[model samples]
Target: MSNQQPPRRFTPMSQFATDYPVLLIDSDAPLRELHNCVSERLNAALKYLHLMACTSLPDYAENDINTVTNIARILVQDVSDVFRVIEPRGFETLKSQ
Candidate 1:
């Protein structure tokens, strides 16, 4: 049988699009790998957030602003990608197994 599945989806605020499209997490991947990916993306998102926090000044050049915006778009895309696999339901369902 074919193994393909439909894309998972997310909504972002009206201000951004990814610099490159972010692919959905592969649910069939090893759980350990998924945890690694979640950690990576969350760390990257945190980095972008920290950088954005520094961009609020009145004298920065346009490229600095664009750099933050572009990465923010990518961060949004990546976080959206990661959250798809974070098991929104509590682990009680797993304990039952």
Candidate 2:
């Protein structure tokens, strides 16, 4: 007999959508505070990625490069929302030179 596993079926979120928006609305902190925390972590992750990207190129593979690029794109997209929180909420930003 061959050693292989059967394909697994994917389940849609609609299968568990009975509660809708109200189910997961609870959180320990306010939404704005959560947004700020997420932004800070994303910014730190981007900085870490920058450092890794600057390191020796010979140690990385084609897949590693692609993975890093994709993750950075996602982090940047989420981080942009931080600006929405900061600016409209009257937080200070550094002036560009």
- Among these predicted structures, which one has the highest TM-score? 1
- Pairs clashing within candidate 1: none
Reference-based lDDT, each prediction: 0.62, 0.55
RMSD of each: 6.4, 16.4
Predicted structure 2, TM vs. truth: 0.46
Q: What's the TM-score of every candidate structure?
A: 0.55, 0.46
Q: Once superposed on the true structure, which residue ranges of model 1 sit more than 4 Å away at CA? A: 1-24, 86-95
Q: Alpha-carbon error at 90 in model 2, in Å?
A: 2.0
Error of 1 at 31 (Å): 1.8
List, residue by residue over 1-97, the lDDT tens digit for candidate 1: 9899764434232233466534445655656776787678678878878876876657778887887778767766666555555564225358778
Q: How many pairs of residues collide in model 2?
A: 0
